[model samples]
Target: MSERQRYAVLNLPAVPEVSAIKIVFNRRSAIIITFTTPEKEHIQG
Candidate 1:
C-alpha cells in the first residue's frame, strides 16, 4: 500500500468553498475541535 499525500490547495481540482463550519472549545480548556465539510471530500466523493 502507498502512503496518501496530504492536502494541498494548489493540487485541488476546483475552487474550494465552505458552506458551513464549526470550531468547538472550552474557554477554560486548551483543547479544540473542528468540524466541516471539506471541499476536497465534498467534490471528490
Candidate 2:
C-alpha cells in the first residue's frame, strides 16, 4: 500500500504532521500509534 494510505489506515495524517510514534510488541503481538496533526500538507516525511 502507499505510505499515505498506510498511515491513513492507522489514523495518521501524513508523516509530516506526525511528530513521533511508538511501537508496542510483546511475544507475538505488535502495534504502532501516534498523535497526528493536520498542520502540514507534505506527502513525504
Candidate 3:
C-alpha cells in the first residue's frame, strides 16, 4: 500500500443559512476547492 498526502481544513460561517460547505487544498501551490454536505457514495452489486 502507498501513503496518502495530507490536507488542511478551513471553516466558514458567513452563510449559515445554507447547508453547503467548502474545502480547500493547498498543495504544490495555493488552490481552492469546494464541496457540499451529504456526499455521494457508490454501491456495487
Give the TM-scores of the predictions, in the order they appear. 0.25, 0.31, 0.25
Error of 2 at 45 (Å): 18
Report the Cα RMSD per candidate: 10.5, 9.2, 10.9
lDDT of each: 0.37, 0.51, 0.39
Model 1: per-residue Cα lDDT over 1-45, one tens digit each:
123432432243532364443333477744342324554433221
Q: List the pairs of residues colliding in candidate 2.
A: none
RMSD of 3: 10.9
| True lDDT of residue 34, candidate 1 | 39
- Model 3 ranges with Cα > 4 A deviation: 1-11, 29-45
Q: Which candidate model has the greater lDDT, 2 or 3?
A: 2
For residue 33, model 1's alpha carbon misses the true position, in angstroms, by 5.2
Best by lDDT: 2
